[model samples]
Target: MARMLGCSSSYLHKKMKSIQISARKRFTPISDANLEEHVRRLHNQFPRSGSEMMRAYLHAEGIVVQRRRVRETLNRIDPAAAAQRWSQTVARRMYHVPFPNSLWHIDGHMRLIRWGFVTHAGIDGNTRLITYINCSTNNKALTVLSYLFGPPVGTGYPPESDRTTEGRILLWLF
Candidate 1:
């Protein structure tokens, strides 16, 4: 090999040693058949590394080459850009139930009506049931009681005469 390169054996060996590479090392620039292949693999693996890192890897493996030369070699062999791309996809599944009353979500919303606070209540869509609703004049004990018990079955909306006994009882209970 030294004679082929037009140098004495000792001089070639000395040169190799000065570069920290053994003359018998398997990797080389244009020879040994697999050098380009190895560099190609490295280029694919470290797509984002600058030329310096590739040079360092080769240097650490005892291959003798300048950092600039290594970068040029890599560019000539692998024409792809240094930047690499990646992505992720996510999917959400819908939930369905077979029957009504299987689930019910209740909530309260307050609105200002003619007299005072009115609470609006409702069930979630999954239940498929109309929400029970009512408007109240006041949130005081008496007003809430009347809304719930409904004017004692049929006292005709509580005449002034009938207002005292039953209404007073319901208000006291609350």
Candidate 2:
């Protein structure tokens, strides 16, 4: 049979098993009217809730419902609300750099400043390479300048432009 069907024997066996299993299973259809009433009640209580939240609320109320059904019901009942919720999602911005050494991103991370350590790092935007990185006791102008200048000064190749956060020290140095 597998040779005639041009498929592996294991694949044919798996397909036959799945068909038999499905044939033995009985499916009970859910009434849309009853489910829609429950969904409407929940939606009235929480107008801002999405499909996943509606499913959770239904589960809490001892009503088991699928997420897709909840979404379809919600969309039919309130298209405007669904559209508003969809629009609330944030869009990602694309980052583009022409060439390596054209632009360098520099930043000072103060996450460890409470423990008396500050981190400064730089990366070539185009190649995504770590040009320089250092941790120091203070994020002073000199320390930041040294971090920015160390790699270029050593290699005798500086970036065309340096991008950094709007810090007073960085602004003053520029």
Candidate 3:
């Protein structure tokens, strides 16, 4: 303890600060070539992060650094501006559309049967509702589109906007 050592607490703290400053001053600034290599490796490993994130990642690897320092280093080493350009591409890839019907998706299924007809179905990409389904050998796009908008065999078509009210006809068909 400071009292046992016959020294004030402030004196101990001051000595600690001096030692820390001296140690820090001894650490050489990362070389331009080394910084570039490290940044390149970090970018390749984590392409989505900006300079700030990369700096934090470096610190986690026990390298002492600041965000602004990392940004400057990155700009100098990769003067061609490769990471920034590639980041825009990655940004575009990260976004996912939230709704169905925003995009209609249709796929066919093969069944074990004499005819093995195509099972065509249309889905609203946003709502994930089965807009229509048809098991036919024809599998014509026009035919399926027509049936979807056409009047039901007996009952009327389900509401276009209402997602909760299941179509009685579809339940029966399945």
lDDT of 2 by residue, 10-129 (tens): 888799897874433332246678778888998999999998999889888777766788888889889999999999988989989988777777788999999999998877878888
Candidates in order have lDDT scores of: 0.52, 0.77, 0.61
User: Ten residues in a row with the worst lDDT in model 2?
Assistant: 21-30
Candidates, ranked, TM-score: 2, 3, 1
lDDT of 2 at 1: 78
TM-scores, all models, native as reference: 0.27, 0.47, 0.35
- lDDT of the structure predicted as candidate 2: 0.77
lDDT string, candidate 1, 1-174, tens digits: 899999998998899899998656554454423545656777778866566787667657666555566666676775465322112224567866455434333333445755475763323245455434456554454554445344233322212111334345443564
RMSD of each: 29.0, 14.3, 19.8
Model 1 alpha-carbon drift over 4 Å, by segment: 1-34, 82-174
lDDT of candidate model 3 versus the reference: 0.61
Question: Which residue pairs show backbone clashes in model 1?
Answer: none
Candidate 2: segments with Cα more than 4 A from true spot? 1-91, 152-163, 166-174
Which of the two candidates, 1 or 2, achieves a greater lDDT against the reference? 2
